[model samples]
Target: MILWFLGLMVVGLYLSFIMMRRSLKRSALIIVFGIGVVGSLLLITLNDNAHFGMVKRTTTNEQTIYTASPNVQMPMLLKQPAGTADKHAVYIYKTDPKKKAVHTKADLAVRNEISRTADTTASLTSQTTRWEYQNGFYGALFNHEGAGQFVSQRNQLAIPKDWFILTTTQAKRLSAKLKVLQHPTAQQKAALATKVKAKAAELVKAEPELATDQTTLMKQAQKAVQQQLIQQAVQDVQQHK
Candidate 1:
């Protein structure tokens, strides 16, 4: 859109020179010159506020959320920053269980929202506001300068019930306490290991394909064992109190 204004301004200058050489003999040049000046100012005004030559479009994308046990359908760990509680922050998650975590794009013009879903799928819906030419004439005139320029964008993410949202600050502070709660004595470890193996067998029996996948089965079993240990720790603490 700015290019349209600048091009008109340049044409207006060229017309001024032609009018000077012709010494006002070509009266038709006056109308052409007037058009050039008016068109330039009109484009400038439109680009400034009205944004007549542009449109906003939206798109959506859905991806699988990584879990502790992919085959067994374990809870997902969604990491966020401390600042996220007050304002929008970057989200880090993995698309696959074995893949590295991916961070969302952080920018001033970018906004983010989150919604909860009943199932386990994660989705990101992006609404981008860019300067798209309304017609072929505007497309040609403003094609070279800032064509398809980004105005703003908004991302809406759908959260699932299986997601365990954790803030970085909270995770750091609770690191030691969580270790204490999850840790077990030698005897406890022996017993917990037996329970975990039994749990793995039970889950595999329910989903037969996990019998060959050691990693997912082990993760699921370990997670269940850790949760039980944490609950036992809390009970012991209450009893002592």
Candidate 2:
């Protein structure tokens, strides 16, 4: 609709210019051409302003709330209350620090347990450790973080049950590890792959349901890991350059 209006304005201006060049009566040409030019300009300005004005109005009304740490932006899922569009009416609160602390401790313990078990059989490489973390409690915690963000942003207290098992600290730690893997040495990469395979085997043994679809699961896991690694590598290069 806006595009059509703009196109019409352009065509009107072009026609007005052509008419001024061809018309024999100078006064008549000036008056007609002047009206066309002024009308087109007014229509274009009004239409553009109306479109942009709506966007600005909507954005102002739907305020995006963030936690104390700017890194974690909460999802907007709540609807505005009946008969109210006031920004001040929106509820905002900090995430519970004590709950987050407890969850982080539990998540660390789980990671340690996995590392100890993997070590008893063979030396765990960075890659293997990453795979294990993704396939285990770390993966579960990621889901919680997502859910927590949604719940918190909506000003709701009832978070996902899984949120009680992981915290923001664990999520940050996993993110740091991923960044380190972005620029691994060749030997480290090889070691990581070997460890990953070993961890996958361990997972199959521990989870019988995964045994039936192990090949498919491993392929999916590998694809997800590689995509993240590639993204991290690109970010690292761009940042340094």
Winning candidate number (lDDT): 1
lDDT (Cα, tens digit) per residue for candidate 2, span 52-126: 112111111121122222233222111112223322222122334222211111121111111112111111111
List, residue by residue over 50-136, the lDDT tens digit for candidate 1.
Answer: 666666654455556554323233344444542535566766666665876676666668777777889667766667777766777
- Show the lowest summed lDDT stretch of 10 residues, model 1: 67-76
TM-score: which candidate is best?
1
Clash counts for all predictions:
0, 0
- Angstrom error of the Cα, residue 122, model 1: value is 3.3
What is the lDDT for 239 in model 1?
A: 46
lDDT of 1 at 124: 65
- lDDT score at residue 33, model 2, on the 0-100 scale: 54
TM-score of each: 0.58, 0.23
- The TM-score that candidate 1 achieves is 0.58
Where in model 1 is the C-alpha error above 4 Å? 1-24, 27-31, 67-79, 82-85, 107-111, 151-154, 173-178, 185-225, 228-241
Which residue pairs in model 1 clash with each other?
Answer: none
